[model samples]
Target: MATYSEEDYLMLSGIQHFAFCRRQWALAHIENQWNDNYLTIAGQNLHHKTDDPYISETRGEKFIVRAMPVHSREYGLTGVCDVVEFKKDNNGTQVFGKSGKYVPIPIEYKHGKEKTNHSDELQLLGEAVCLEEMLFCHIDYGYLYYGKTRHRKKIEFTLALRQELNQTVLEMHSYWQRKYTPRVKPSQKCKSCSLRDICLPELLNRESVNEYIERRLSE
Candidate 1:
């Protein structure tokens, strides 16, 4: 597998889009065109809330919250994580544990309630993959904290998910090599995309239909 530098490739979060729809991913990331909607603005503000540094200790558990810059050389991905939780593992034997064990957990914050989509899950998994490579540990699971529900959902980094994530890494690199701007193909997900206006999938669909008819007539 060919690996590229972090600066040479776009962030791994883009892989989530490639999994959702390749064209959508290219249109937003490659073209660098984005439409700011209320939802995106709200999401930005929500992320801003957690961007700062803070430490909270409660009930013998310590929580350190801060943004993290992550990258994967093998995956050629780079992005920042919203928050990570570090806690000391009390379950350690005296002889075996010279120092107290510390566990690192990644927590991603979303602006909306849980939806019937894998985009968020893939993004989190990508982050986990990067963390695993950097920390050289097996990250078995993480949590997604939904703003709407105001609750955390535990996600297991199963073998299946890891396989899919690896595939995404490969696909994203291939797409970046093409370096062609993607046209919009509207779908249910478009309603929430911040690049809806720039993508204009509906308009592109119409154009495609018209071109098909014209080509048929000429034939």
Candidate 2:
């Protein structure tokens, strides 16, 4: 398997943006454009609540780690997981300095309720891939904790999901290599996009004055 050097690694968080929209990913990652909308601000605040790296707590058989750094050389990705819960299990791998074997379950905190899109799920899976690589263990499941609903949704890390994640990372690296920003395709989702004004999806949708004049001349 191929491995990426530290300099070549991309942000694992970009998986969510890439899954949401390629143009969005290019704008933020390539063009370095970002805007703070209410949704984004709230999301940031929610992350702030859990982004502390020094906190680790033990609850019964579970050891909870916050803001754990993880990376996967195979995917060329690195990021901080919001939470990694190590549940004690006889079948799990032994954690260093811990008494028993435990399963590493990544838990991501989302600001909103569950959406129809797979962006959040893909992001969580990316984190799982990193943990699996860093810990040298197989992770079969993860969780997404939503602030809006105050609920945790479990996700299965299946073979198909793993394949999709690998493909997504490959595409991300290709785009990064080319430094490409894809053209805008306007949609309802644009309304909620943080970089909507900078992306100008609405302007891209409308015909330019020059184009209108050209069409009139042609007519």
Candidate 3:
């Protein structure tokens, strides 16, 4: 049997939650459990919409959408992008007729409306980080194409977001190094989590406290 390294432990999307909530990241990635609800299913289906290969012409620019596999060894993350658009840059003229270059814009499709936080932004930013490292270029912005609003919202990859992304990568590495699974910290988000059944946070908490009391009595 082949042994999986700690580098193989990180999930690309997990970095998002690790930034939002460390416990949530550990629950999903470390525990190996997930429970899919209607929202998650709908979001997944939205991604499927862009999974196929297709090209579109818009205002003299060609947009090629592809489901590309992306990975970053530096961040220890790997995942697939829903749609990556390549636009030709005709500004610099030197090598090949105004030098057409590839500018990668990763579009993430979500099922629900935008949230009042940076969770979604962080996720997209993580993808941008991976793309930047892979492409060796500055990706200034990307779009979050939402199904609910039926529009594409431009996201500026700010310095703060980049900092958060770096912090998330470091924390995920630390969490993945731990041998024991973390205790569940349940919240309303858990209701939407697919791992609720397997996690059994409420039950686990009760059992843990009971065992602690029993051990004290025995002592």
Candidate 4:
């Protein structure tokens, strides 16, 4: 399908989790399972601080919008952007109530520092692509703000990255359609995963931690 209806659109944020671990994504998104570890709680707090739909400000040439809703029908994805800074530019497009044309730059906030994996980049690119579809503009890059290190890192949306994103989203859609959840392949990353206990990689079955506990108690 060239495009998906709004109803078919999947959660755009799930790409990050899917990239980190497909099982993690399936558990949280498909199985409706989740747990709040320190990292997740911290990330939620950071998102809360940054995501306020009512908050919009004009800073000279920059118009800042918090919790901007964005989507891409082509990718069948939807999510809220933490911050979308519209900077005044002659080559940019016009805003609804604003006077001048502006280019949108998306900034994502994470509780932890930069990771060795490309999960963060994949998620950021998903947002950028969604914005491109919504704004009808080309965004060469965006920003990733690390909550732990308190630093902002620039992320370029390269041709290779876009290709990778396309593949990732397609895989996600296929899995979603089948309601498929893959078995866990244990790794060091599991140690810090928020859903580690729920996943119970050691068992590598459909059973959940609570279910296992209850069954053991009866036995």
Best by lDDT: 4
RMSD of 1: 6.2
lDDT (Cα, tens digit) per residue for candidate 2, span 166-213? 888899999999987776668889889998777765555565333544
Minimal lDDT window, size 10, model 1:
90-99
C-alpha lDDT values of all predictions:
0.71, 0.88, 0.69, 0.91
Off by over 4 Å in 3: 1-9, 53-59, 90-99, 203-219
Over 4 Å off, model 1 = 53-61, 90-99, 182-185, 202-219
For candidate 1, the per-residue lDDT at 58 reads 37
lDDT of 3: 0.69
Tens digits of per-residue lDDT for model 1 on 113-218? 8867677788898888787777666677888888888989999988998888878777776767877655644678777777666565656645543354467699
TM-score of 4: 0.93
Model 1 per-residue lDDT at 187: 71
Where is the poorest 10-residue window by lDDT in model 3?
A: 90-99
Model 2 per-residue lDDT at 77 = 94
Who is ahead in TM-score, 3 or 4? 4
User: Candidate 3, residues 19-94: lDDT per residue as tens digits?
Assistant: 5556656766775546677887998898777776564434344355567777766666677777777666643112
Candidates, ranked, lDDT: 4, 2, 1, 3
RMSD of each: 6.2, 5.4, 6.2, 2.2
TM for every model, in the order presented, reads 0.80, 0.90, 0.78, 0.93
Better of 2 and 4 by lDDT: 4
Q: TM-score for model 2?
A: 0.90
Candidate 4 lDDT over residue span 72-183, tens digit each: 9999999999999999998888888889789999999999999998899999999999988888888888999999999999999999999999999999999999988887
Residue 89 alpha-carbon offset, candidate 4, angstroms: 1.4
Lowest lDDT sum, 10 consecutive residues, model 2, at 204-213
